[model samples]
Target: MTEESENTGGLARRTLLRLGAAGGAAAAVAAAQTWAWPLLAQRGLVSPDGAFAAASTVFSDALYIEAFPTSPLILSPFNDPLPVLKALAPVPKTVFSKWPQPPGPGPGQQNSLRNERHQVWTSQVGLPDPIVYKINLLVRTHSFTTSQVLPIDKDGRPAVSFDAKRKTYAAGTKRFLPPSTIYGFNGGFPGARINAEYGRPVLVRFENHLNENPLNLDRQDFGSPDLSFLTHLHNSHTAPESDGNPHYSMVAGPRHRGYRPGMFVDNLYLNRPAGNDDGQKQSFFWFHDHTMDHTGANVYKGMVGLYPIYDPKNGMDMGDETRGLRLPGVRTNNPDGSFDVAYDIPLAFTDFRFDDGVTIHKDFHDGQGEFPAAKNPATHPEWWGKTFYKHFPNHGFVGDICTINGTAFPVLEVKRRKYRFRFLDASVARIYEFKLMTSTRGPKSSASLGYNGEELQGQYRIEDGQQCMQFNEIAVDGGLLPVPIKRDSFELWPAKRREVIVDFTRYQDGTPTTKGDVIYLTNVMKMPNGRKWAASTRFSPDPNYKIPLLKIVIGDTVPDNSLVPTALRARPPLPSNWQSLLDNRLIFEVQRGSAGGELEWLINGKPFDPFHALPSLKNPAGRTPLAQQKKGSFNLWELRNGGGGWVHPVHLHQEEHQVVMRNGKDVTRTPDPGHPDDISGEDTAALDPGESVILYRGFRDFTGPYVGHCHNLSHEDHAMMFAWEITP
Candidate 1:
């Protein structure tokens, strides 16, 4: 298609009007003739009719339907039943082919593992519901090379590096990523959950065998087809190459003559605590594609998976009920004789938009594409998927469907026992304020309290809205808190994870709850435009996202083997020299700008650049550094929000930092017995406009490149990130 034609393409308003008229005349005919789901999937386009259905289905699919879990909860820490030890080059060609369609569903729809490469480790859990049903696992192993290696001086002194010719690679065409298709780790979606031990040394070799040419890159006029990757382990103590800094993204394929293609990158995870201090160790971390200019879209396409670390000897080990902390763990086989991560469940919450034909949605926009800044064109001839406005892309995308562990509005049969839920919001741009409530069969009531005395957070017109459940939050992004905090509800921004323990057998007051009671996992934060949430007490929830997420039907009682501890782990005291470092704190101003009819999310007035060296004393050369710190050193950093009525969840990689103060005032520390330590540290913090936070971060145990960015991936993808180095 010509550039002019592509620019003019999309489901225009006039076409929507025609579809409306056709729908009124004959609903069945409109559905049949316009819903070309298969063709739409193949071509990556959504017709006006499909767009309309996709928009309205959110409320319809979630509000009225009552569903139950037909499959067991997915357990992580579960090994790939079929682990492929050998690696292959050029990634299997079939890796980019249309994923096989599962039986009785949308054509070319991929929900579970069906191919041989993927079948080794993944399997599907079938459900009878026709609305939308499928569970697919993503897995793969590829081999490729790259020359984007970090440079060091001849004397082997890091940071004060050498190789002037190596610097020229940045100016070379080959400096950028090669043409390749994107896929989840091990080549599958929700990639495999990697279970590693804290303080352990492990080597991970990532080979990029992405298809040399993927369909999304076919149109040179739109979207990023960069076939390189920068895999960040969120907040792990790893060398620079493994930190997955956007500035250090690596590409595959043969390099120009004499230059070897930088395809594979080996990351060494020290697995040590952020500062070598036992109290600062992180338990739950994840790995995902962090390629610059494409983190958001790449992750949206499913380049994310779990990487949970543990201190086998001193950790909350769920490996066996007889060892370690003994909390409900993986390896605890279910009645079906299949094993899963038991009470220690990882719920990866994400949202998606589908075309009216029910295929996944994709919006193509290269900085130079027509309507590059606009989500939809006011007047266009071809369907460009669904949009709320004309010609501009949405500030943030929010799908009508909220999926957990890859299932849409499904049911979970929980035993009348305590379960530890690890909630990770992996959405590209959706925030969820979750609440646990019970259902009522008759007309919805206006009650704001549970049958007993549980304090309800918001009004749920879907049923008798009683906030019957409460969560004992044990940890934040960094790991387990010094102590737990019990709250009626908690807000989860994208890319944030919270560990909470919920006891299904009792109410908040320790009263034995009914054995057959049914409850729901609901969202109440009403985010109409995917913007900042309203200011309100944690208990007084936002009513906007009040949709049901999971249905919990109290099942038969099982032998309870887990217990929420009185204390998990305590954080160690700061280094004695911490006070001195505080005087020279690093300050990052989260700023935004508008230019050429587009909004820019930035840090310190600059978009992310890997080579933009920082002016610092340690490395006088300032080799493209945003911030610099000596290895094994401690420093204070301040996150300042540039007011614009927006909330930024700042996430720091490579280490977890403790939030010491907010808005110039010391944060009141909360002590809970459920944790082994006090809650004072975090990897991601939500900063409201006009707000600021001071964090104490440690750059210890490793030296290399790392990143700190807004976890609201939409913001990060648009340049709200920076690269920093740890010097030796």
Candidate 2:
């Protein structure tokens, strides 16, 4: 067909499509428009889409610990049913499953293992509602000749130091687990729960044992033995040292890094030189290996975990220190007339796929077209996978299945009282919605507090603070963003912590019994986002990624006598005046491009390719002049999207933004959506895309080393990136 004729024909078809869609309701048309989902998984290449990987290769050995607390292991100590094993590479692919429940036993039990390598592990961890984590990190260097090995001590755990000579790793084009790579927390790979309370600190030791050569990953964007690594603490605002600023990276071999915690913070030190600092906030967040080219490899192999900071002054006991009521209604106190509530429950929700016996770390390229590693053979001496010159690219094939708390279809027992639940969307490219069902089959209180879509903008009336100021200059040292959630009640978001009260007094059996209560936290987001999420389908679907997360259970049920609590976490002494300030700002737009390319999630309009660095955020020009905004002032932002794709967990680097306005209105999605789906309040906003939702603001404490990006690990590492610095 002639170019003009083809264009004309395409235009005509699209017009007809629109006309037909218009006949339907706006929402239906919008939904239908996205129904065309691009043709991403088209290429005739071998894609790992609906596949399965080998199970974990169990590796048993009591990691000898010198320190009393056992000082953590390289990966093991994994409990039964989930024996920590080193599964051989290239295992078949398989999706993860969520059994048991999450927030379980904190560490080893937090997440499940589902591989899309064509394989992965699935399990669950049990924890009291809201849990916090402080992750330490180390990045690995790759070597082609030798399998970039992460050595362990006598007992069978990654040792701080290795017994063999740390040879200079041979460099190879960045791909998944290609020998040596730098990543977050403990070397390469991720875990179940990588989130903490709203504001917390995370400390990591990015030990560069191999003294990686930049040429190893990318000749240009490389690190030194001092090859510093910046940690995004994914979604928090923390101290200058803590902010994941590429500018603040330092020597890893024997260095320690520190950071406070809060929200809307930046990761300025992401790839720049270290020894300096960028002011920012710290909130409930995670830390991942944030090096250039190597990020994909490091993160996929697992290098992420929760990082949070906190003050114990305010007390309530779901699992906290103080004591209070059980459910969500009334107000009571200890012998001392003080309101009380339960500790927020944090559920680190992440999905994985395993292939063969290898879990293609999320972010590792699938060797599909586009980012195919250089086949020069000369450039990479130790390159393996000769048949096709394989390399783990900066992304992984979507996996299938879901898991929570380390268990598949896991269950938890909760009280009829009030409880706080915090959720984290740790999936690679999955958009999720939630649904709480009745265990009428069992005896427990139904959910009163429901789900909230605070992230979506342009649905309801908006309550806000201010826009990101280009001006205001308040030196943030190390504080937190505690933007009061202005609602008649509570709300929740992915990676969000909410204090909710579930009263069972009415459904209670009149008895002085002491049996525990059990509740299930089902996932409806999987199906919704599956059909609703926007992806170009640009290339044919990669087998691994398209899978479900997992189901969860709420446990630790209590009796009516000392059950439901009067208050949730005690308010920080009823704010006399609102606090929390924004030192600077960064707005990111996540979306998908045409077919043949992976879906896109960009900051401004750029991706973070170490090879193709993003535009200079530093005084960016060439575009419309950026308006000078107020600093030290609360800012309001209307998070808008391109629409027609899956959703993303947009996390800020320096401040905790309260979802005030959605769809130009003020409506908050309760923690419970309930029967039918009541989104009546003005605070509720469901961003179908192209619409703006205003999220009110508070303030940030310190400003140095921060970032604003997607919480979805894959996007964060692949490209969707930006920085927000509060220059003193």
Candidate 3:
């Protein structure tokens, strides 16, 4: 998609309507390639206007990097992220100080200036071993090892990395190095992971260092207030003060008019079980930027990382080959000559786009309002370093590039044995339908007509290419399932985590599959609209959306010591007296706004007003949150989806719920097509358009504010979120 394709051509409404008409998946795809692409070309839906528009090749060109292979499972030396958070010199007072500054003092201005915020712990898990971490948010640049020649700017200067021996920044040169500029935690993209142990407490002190960024910010069009900090550890059981609620955002700079500027917040997390039962304990969680209305931009800039809780008593310690369920553990250097690597891995899935092929897009910021091209000429023009649709696109940000664990098209070397991979969809919007298939080849760098899902179907289709392996489901968002479910392919929505055991020793046919064999973890869901793929869309034979994520090459045969247990810890079953509790059911509706000049994603019909909760039968004043529950009570929460051609992966903070019913039917073990398990006792649920789900959620132990909202960062940034409190 070139700048020339930005024009919306006159493809009559009738044609666009027919493209979505009822038909077989093949017909729909044929219509898309035959008619939709052409119309979209005229309309310029693919190519955004401006210098910073994502390169058309991002969508059209197939990924082709092979070296710089292994995906890094970001683990911190300590359980806390604070050690990595260091202080940088303050920005020199100058003309470019309009962007907020870190409050307090300059480098040599004051001797007493220091971060003052502290945390006070309440509950304990097993033991009270507390660890503290200090993390800073800063803008920096780093080289992403890739094979594609970084695209050159208009001046013919290379945008890629420079030769290590010689580094120079010269215009119009074939050999210039320009690392991707990004906003990151501790200046590291995909910030460090926290290996927290159950029963131990962790405290993180977050400081705002964005003011020290060398980049100019006055000319940006990013949504929400700039230079603010609100770090939220998603799905953690913590107090409201540490929950990272939008209302409690701390802006950088000096205090003003009683609203004092805050430079830091020490968040305390009690890595304890949701209840006395082991099933209430959570295993996988991640922390990211949750600034009021700017979550999408901040997170996209790389403020995300993983946090896996290890409970020795709960079989979380895979390192012990003798004790517990000795699953493969993380790789570790051993004192002996041999190595000690846990085939257990973590994959954080994310998408990013570089303006050309190297300089990543940076969003410009405007105040908290939509900037239309007609009214805002200065900010509307697509420029280098901006998203395709300027500030914020209502549809959601789905990048053309797919990155896992910070690498693009990387390869993983696995032993011929069972391994556990924790997959987390960190994409802002894209929903992935993943499958494992035998090797298939296409042009390494050919123009792939993105979204023509049916075109390249035959070769990679499972029937043509053998089904390589399957995933034995072990855990969901909050924690482990009651029983392990097996599946060929699984779908993961943003913010959802699925942990599975994959054995490379045996192929689908139970043949002795081993070394030299190659398989790809690929995506098949045809989602060109940043929403759910339509029902008529064919996913099986879809080649248009077929993109290999990780290439797994079977290596040497390893000792088989690990085993997948028949069952995992069990979550509390639905209250046996549910019929008597029907009268207490509470409903929340997720909807899109009708006043549509600009799109408004909402919960109920209102935009987020953090201070005001929508009025409900339980809260007559509407001022009270939707549901103010007693700390230990179990309540049936009904989530009703307002039909609007979207699937919302609804996520709730602090508490994990058990699905009681979906669409008025009792939740059962009957699995959906690719998902071979039951959807129950999960923190996040995928709510389809026009569907309704009833869940049993318990508000126990800790008390304070929490939220339930669409995990879609774009939607969450909008008003599709609501707050509730747990009373003591």
**Candidate whose lDDT is highest:** 3
Window of ten residues with lowest summed lDDT in model 1: 251-260
Which scores higher on lDDT, 1 or 2? 1
* Residue 531 miss distance in model 1 (angstroms): 2.5
Deviation (Å) of 37 in candidate 1: 45
Model 2: per-residue Cα lDDT over 1-728, one tens digit each: 11232132123222322222232124322332343223222323223221100000000001011110111111111111211112111101121113232222232332122110100011211112221222334444422122132322223233332111222322221222233343334343343232222222122223333333333443211222123344545444334444444423322111222121111111221211011111122223445555532343344444455433222323222234333322222223334212233333445554432111111112112212122343221122222211011122212323232334332233444444443443444444444443233333331111111212211110111121111101111001122212212222122233332322333322223432134433234333322232234322222322212221222233345543344322223112212232231112223355532220133335555554222223322222233212123335454444556554444456554444445434445434332222111121111223443554445543433433344455444455444555444443
Q: Model 1 lDDT vs. the true structure?
A: 0.52
Off by over 4 Å in 3: 1-126, 149-178, 214-225, 247-262, 314-321, 330-341, 356-391, 442-466, 534-544, 617-625, 668-679
Model 1 misplaced stretches (Cα beyond 4 Å): 1-182, 212-223, 250-262, 314-318, 330-340, 356-394, 442-463, 534-545, 575-581, 594-597, 614-626, 668-678
Write down the RMSD of all candidates, one decimal each: 19.6, 20.1, 12.1
lDDT of each: 0.52, 0.30, 0.56
Decoy 3 TM-score against native? 0.73
Clashes of each: 55, 258, 25
TM-score of 2: 0.46
